[model samples]
Target: MSESANDTAQPVTDWEGYSFDTRQVHAGEYPDRNTGLRVPPIAMSAGYVFDDFDDQVDRFAGRSIDPIYSRQGNPTNAVAEERLASLEGGTGSVAVSSGQAAISSALFALAQHGDHIVSTASIYGGTRILFGRSFKRFGIEFDYVWDADDDAEWERAIRPTTKAIFTETIPNPRNDVTDLRRIAEIAARYNLPVVVDNTVGTPALIRPFEHGADIVVHSTTKFLTGHGAAVGGAVVDGGRFDWAAAERAGRAYPLITAAPRPGLGSMLDRFGTGAYARAVREAVVNDIGPSLSPFNGFLLHQGMETLSLRMERHVDSSLSIAAWLEQQPEVESVDYAGLPSNALHGLALRDYDGRTGSVFGVAVRGGIDGARAFVNGLRVFSRMTGIGDTRSMVIHPLSSTHATFPQEINDRLGITPGLLRLSIGLEAVDDLKRDLRAGLDRVAALATPAVSLAG
Candidate 1:
């Protein structure tokens, strides 16, 4: 007998039409029939046993979607993948080893050698590096549009070989929110699918699909995992992109829309709305072998249970702290869109309800000296190179994440000597404020004159 057939209480598999809070807790959770385990247990097996010879053949022949190897899929990871897909309103999702892997797999399925991709210039520093170095080495070209609003710039960048348009929902170190609707419109004109990295802006704050994105990627290591414990990533298929339409328009995605063998059908034909995600799993992730560990997969599902509750605290604290930082005398500027004075505040109000996100940039009065002093003075905020953590963290972007970039690129990105990226955590608001004040005090002291040695 099947696990569900024998169990008295069946798991809630379909999370559609449920509230975000309800789905996050209950969606994708399967009851353990053998032991009646309340929570989904870690599926540690590398392979599953088949009942007979035909069962194994059917799986290999694409007649069934059963897992043949842990490298492609895992039950523990499936819970997290399904929960995330439901949360993001996608048809399906694929979990991977890291955010970079998710991005690489998502794009590799769409564009291969000789193909090109257009991206919004403002994105994660690591992503930019990946595109410039590894993707370039693979013969996959990338063109960047500095201004998303400028149709001319976008037109100039997008070419006949362009397979997709890439961007971020809430780009960090500078919380400048992208206008997904506008980009989607541009993409529709060219029949290109829009791939968005909703890493900084988790589904709690913004569902990119709702705003017209065709695909969504996440660095589950950050906000989705909630804690700093596990490092994982996921790619969600919005299920709305018309694959046939894009192919007709001359941008072919063979991995998703083409068949693998003489007798087999295409992923699009077999899976319909879920084709892209299946292609990412079978074609890219399986071949490259960036499978997420079941151990981290367990942590991912558990972390998502309290996503909304954690995000509320994260955004609430960020709004308060951004406002406070803007008023500090030693602070040069704040890059949080939640601040009314910010250039992107209008966009933030329109889409994000003024709660942009926790990670943002703050420039102190002094140059690198002020940044060094401020970083050294912070007792509460950690001096680190990560964002979206439960603990408040600070890092000088110009000297760290953006260090390898050319001076011109850093200048364009506004990564100045004194600019520091702050990832606010679930810590007390007052304590976080005090920590900022201490950092500012250090910056203020940089300008203070000392007594003459002669005296």
Candidate 2:
């Protein structure tokens, strides 16, 4: 698991090509000066003190960079945002309330009434619903590339109103590896900026910007925080997309290029290279009120300090458990991409240098009934909807995460009744295997039950 060169970051400073571990510990942060505290303290203020009336005017007028209200920004949250931005190789970032808010804000900032987005059919069920239900109600439309590997599909679905291309770095459960470079290539022809959900493939595993992603987002509740304690999200701008140029070339992104009002300039005109990020912060996050609390930001930053270590163990344990499960007689199949037999193994190797992500699907020999027994048999693994937690968790998607979806949609997503999504955690590999084996043993018993039905 640790053989790959890309899996481990080189030991160096952030500027001198810092390793992943180094950045995790020191990126976008430094010791305090006023009190000279080694570990920085969280700023718990609701608002900052204005120097005077002129200072207030300057802040409101965009002349001052100092924070105004906690609803808009906070010092502690700012550190987390910058830390994530640096780790993801982004020029700027804005932390939001949750991963959902991050995705919502980014989408809303990029489009409005009558605009559209091109996305992969494979996405988080929550995001699929958000795009299908909430965003649709906003008068915006969505066009999904059911098969993103096909270049023609992406090209065909993109309309002039298509404002952005969305995809996940590593789609959950299915473990389907997205050809990020391929999708970015397809989006480039249309002058579209690719927005990648990097929650699964956090920067420690694979840096999407290195593969041409224009924007990166994270559900800090997941691996970025390395624990399930904090619920937060962030949007990171690569600052590589030329919004003004795209609009000039007829691939218009009105949210960026169009003037906000009759006289005022557009985001692109105001912020230059940081147009998208600025809009996400000022127009969407600020106005819509999905602000991340400073306390949560401090927690997220602390979690990031151990991100590299957690990711390393998570990958190793996941590979171990997946391999052991494949050998079990009660196991039908495992959808882990790290295994050589899986279809996306090569892609994962190339993208991550050998670390397949921790989340994947496991299908027991029995169907939904078998799934129920399997989950019921587990002792150490917690059955929950969240992923990337320090404690291992299990979720039955057909009845949990995607239970509300129609049968056809579930089938389309390959979410069979027997499939149980396992988020492998930081537990000992052998212990995890034993726990799974115990479930498999019960799975066989479930099939041959002693039902005393006296008719």
Candidate 3:
């Protein structure tokens, strides 16, 4: 789709000052190509018909023209991108193969061989692995600031080569609410872009851009997709950060210096509003080839139509279950900020209006054996690694998702042996409670006999 028509088709109300709920339903809906139908269709074509040779040359020369290939852009992907951009209050978006790919592309777009990234230690297990190991091979150094809550920690972690400050809105398993505004301030001081993973606290729950985040990324495969069917990710450029300003401040980002383009100027100079996003699309997404399938994009779009409704149920049911679990003796602690007793409750209340996401971790009194028994005993909640599915899911982070992290790192990140992470679904609350009770009962039974031995 050409930017000329699509950009002027419908002013994105959310991005263009529309309310959140209204934007969710009508953000990037293009009238049908053939029949002028309201819903945008999945364009499965691999290439587009150019008007002329000059237009083809213009397309290749970074002119604002329609897409040329499926790998670079598709109508289906464009709809998703528009919707995401609208929802995240961004200038534009790029859908990628996976969340890790989104993170990788976004980082590589701004940082290079000699550049560095300052990140919150509390983040997804896969993200941790990607930054700690994968990016290292490319000579891109990533340092973690353990105390993300401490502004001083983030300030100290920034190096002259640091190009971005990365953190999750609500870190998986940890469930700690990041102070986006504070982090944004810290990033502004250094003239670095703030990249936030808002997968958990989807836009329905929290909009990071409003708090000064320069860019937002999501594992659309999670809550945004609403179901566990697709594997995709999206990056949204808030269009707020002045990349040109960063460059003016002596920040030499890779896409500005290394990418091959003679008259195109630096990414910072060309795409004033979408410099980072355009860089990722042109350089990493085009060269590295992390494109989302059109079919997956269709599924993700369908999922988005009902996202707000699903999130409401997920949050309500999760809060109910988390509260019940807090009263259980078997549960040593519940790591849900919605619970008044949680250490992060105050922060969550302040930032998220007391909505602490559906995904949370519960610490059992007993250790690994107890955790395994509880997960296996659950009837309704599927024992899987993924979260934000329509159906409830349970997993032992220590033994599964966070297993890659060394024990010391895992512990430091608040993933302990007794903790079980749950992705609450839209199932009947009573039914979910019954299913959870069965698992907790089993843990209690096993723990009762084991306590005698300790005595």
TM-scores for every candidate against the unseen true structure: 0.97, 0.93, 0.93
Between candidates 2 and 3, the lDDT winner: 2
Better of 1 and 3 by TM-score: 1
Clashes of each: 0, 0, 1
Instruction: Return model 2's CA RMSD, one decimal.
Output: 6.4
Candidate 2, poorest ten consecutive residues by summed lDDT = 8-17
Per-residue lDDT tens digits for candidate 2, residues 87-114, read 8888889999999999988888778899
Query: What's the lDDT for residue 162 in model 2?
Result: 89
lDDT of each residue in 1-455, candidate 1, tens digit only: 55665676656677789999999998899889899899989999998898799999999988899989999899999999999999999999999999999999999999989999999999999999999999999999999999998999999999999999999999978998899999999999999999999989999999999999999999999999988999999999999999999899898999998999989999999999999999999999989999999999999999999999999999999999989888889999999999999998889999999988899999998899999999999999989878888999999998888889999999998889999999999999999999889988989998999868894
lDDT of the structure predicted as candidate 2:
0.86
Instruction: Name the runs in model 2 displaced over 4 angstroms.
Output: 1-16, 258-266, 449-455
Q: What is the Å distance of residue 455 in model 1 from its true position?
A: 4.5
Q: Which one wins on lDDT? A: 1
What's the true lDDT of residue 316 in model 1? 96
RMSD values for the candidates in order, in angstroms, are 2.4, 6.4, 4.6
